[model samples]
Target: MKSNRVALAALLGLIALPLVVREPYFQHLMIMVLLWVTIGTGWNLLAGYTGQVSFGAAAFFGVGAYTAGLLSFHLGVSAWWGLALGGVVAVLVGFPFGWIAFPLRGAYFALGSLALGEVMRQLATIWESFTQGMMGVLIMPTFLSKLPYYYIALALAAGSVLVVRLVLGSRLGYYFISIREDQDAAMSIGINTTKYKMISLSLHAFLTGTAGALYMNYMGFIDPHVVFSLHDISIMAILVGIVGGVGTVYGPAVGAFIMVALQEVFRSAGFGALEALSKAIGGGFMAGLTKYVSQAHVLAFGILVVVVIMVLPNGLVGDWRKVSRLFKRAS
Candidate 1:
């Protein structure tokens, strides 16, 4: 009952965010956070619950983006169609890969998924005629205002979480947890671990792919590199899952908000405030410090990740009580 109330409150807060913060730039950031919430939730479902860690999420992500873009490019169909078909295509692609790759365990499985991403990237780039060879797929965005996208993203994030919560509550979720705990033991009990893992992968692919299609509709542009990027897309998903509290529902949502906010802070050089502050203070060392801070975002991010791992290894959700205590002590 408490969980339900919390969920309701959080939803209400998100719904009211845009009304309170009307700045176009901040609205854009919220949209990005919500999008990552979907992607991160998908990643957590597979890796956190099913014990399948994929480094090739970008493969599914890219496939969805391309599916949406191709419809607009070739058939002159609206890109919105991709929201449905893109996920289907990603499942079609992920099904075979999961069937073949699930047999591999641990790091091997991770590498296999990574290889899948590389293959997809190569195909997207090498196939110039169909994909435009890195020129990217561009579509006409449907909405001029960010409001529509914001609400759509909120719906997706909430829907995905609700779906995951349902799945985790059922017998199938039990099977997934069993596989994650011990595949050999699960197989001994006749769990058909492979089958269950495939189902989990399909769910993951579907959610991630849908988010990719959303990206296409919202951004109106996508290339192999942006969608299929191993580091930017794949690794970022992993980081979101890890930092937010792996295996905890709503962990990815928290992590997504934190990470996206951090990225913007780094990318924007403290949202261009530091420079203004330095100018107001009469330059020299302060000017140099501002310049250094902008370039140091990546380094800062790396250090923060390390600290989080060491201090809150279970992630923010898993370690919430510890965090609360620390704050109490400080006060």
Candidate 2:
């Protein structure tokens, strides 16, 4: 009960953030964090809970992005409509793909998902007439201010978390866990493993696709490479799930916040803190250090992942007891 109050307070604080800090750049970062939370939550539903690791989150993301972009480009409809329809389209795509990929197990399923994402990227690039190919799609954004986008993203993230929590409390949730723990055991108990797996995939795809649609509207542009990049979208989703605590309800929320902060720190060279220090120090050494740090964000990310895996294999939330013990020892 005390934890719930603290969580509610934190959420309320986040909801009131834009009113206090009106900076567009910070708001943009918050938006990204919320978006990742949504995607991470969906990915967790399928991979973390159902024991199905997917590398094709980018496929659904790209499909929804294109769905929104295309509607505005061709039909002259509001791209906003895509927010509602995008997830549906993603489900349609995932249904057949899951049917085929469900037969594969473990690493093979992961590979199949990776291949699916690659195929989607290739198709988006090759089909020039329909998708405009690599030229990309551009659209006018509805809102001039970042506040609306931020709030919408926050709501979406909150909704995804709530839906997952409710599902995990139901009978289907147990079935998902059973399959994840031992598919053979789940099947022997009269559970249709394939159907449940497909259901998980569909839910995952829908949430991811909704996020993609949001991205299209927020960013005002879309390209196959940007949306469907394996490392950027797919692997990041996996990292968010793993780093946050895969099977835990609130893990992705915490993971998303940490990963985004880490990404920005390296991407911006410690958010320009290093550059300021370099100027104060007045030396080539400091300048060189800043340059190296800026260029090594990816390396830093890799090291962070490795360190987290080694130190807290189950993630921050999942390993709360270990973390508390470490703090106690330090004190």
Model 2 residue pairs with clashes? none
Q: How accurate is candidate 2 locally (lDDT)?
A: 0.93
Q: Estimate the lDDT of model 1.
A: 0.90
Candidate 2 per-residue lDDT over residues 159-266, each given as its tens digit: 998889889989889999999999999999999999999999999999999999999999999999999989889988988988999898888998999998988998
Per-candidate Cα lDDT values, in order, are 0.90, 0.93
**Residue 223 of model 1, lDDT score:** 89
Residue-level error in angstroms, candidate 1, position 140: 0.9
Candidate 1 least-lDDT 10 residues? 293-302
Kindly report which residue stretches of model 1 are placed more than 4 angstroms away from their true locations once superposed.
278-292
In model 1, what are the clashing residue pairs, if there are any?
Answer: none
